[model samples]
Target: MKKLVFIFALSSFALTACSKPENKPVQESAQTAPQESAQTAESTAASQPLAAGDTAETSLDWAGEYKGVFPCADCEGIKMELELKSDKTYELTEEYLGKGAGKEFKSKGTFSFDTKNPSIITLDKAAENRKFFIGENFAEARDMETGEAIDSQLNYKLTKEAN
Candidate 1:
């Protein structure tokens, strides 16, 4: 009976010793997870700023004959011809036919950009106000003609047309 009691006490000690501790170092590392994440975030945020000489080159690569049409619901169909100049300015001529009034319009404008996501082009013209949304590969513009708002968006795929 004494040997049996000794064996039972030894088994109990072995079981208790083999079990995991109530406080683990692995779990304590998990508690510091938020601090590690905050440090990573701070490091990333500190690394992104526009350096000097980061200004984009502004030139007229848009010197071509662009044909556009306004497909608005309540108005006549309008046709536009945009001639871009070598000096980053533009000449706009438009013709409207179908419903409200029949007229031809002409304007001259200069464009400038803002380098945010989906950049902007501000057009200063003689008879109309215009704004263009400038992207990496394409551009679109909205303008007012004879007190009517005309919005046009174009996605350009460059191809050589036969002369």
Candidate 2:
């Protein structure tokens, strides 16, 4: 077993050492340049900010369902599903895991972009819940009254689900 391990390690080092470096960087190579350019174009599209009343979806199409399990203080996590429509309506279904498992809460309301920041969406006054910072592919959950991001070990942003 020891000899086999040593042989494997030596062979791996020899193969790595024998490999030659490319003359140009991968991004600049002919074969990879087109792919890299496409990726750069997509990144540029996703980075552009959307304006209020534009009625156009974000670069990655923000009109969809976003689901995530957010960190919770007492419970295991809070499983949430938020659906944002092009018509400016939203439906949020949340269930607290573990301790509050069977109890699900659903909040349906109209959403509007924040007056000062178009990317930040606020729920109707009735919901009185947190706002979401809209991005290309995800909406980050934030504190309602304070507008501060929710601190958590787990990812606080809801990932978009494919239709």
Tell me the tens digit of each residue's lDDT in model 1 across 24-112: 65677778888899999889768977543343334334444455665535556666666555576877777785774568888887855
Question: lDDT of all the models against the reference?
Answer: 0.56, 0.81
Q: Which parts of model 2 have CA positions greater than 4 angstroms off?
A: 1-60, 151-154
Give the winner by TM-score: 2
TM-score, prediction 2: 0.61
TM-score of each: 0.46, 0.61
Error of 1 at 159 (Å): 11
> Top model by lDDT, which number?
2
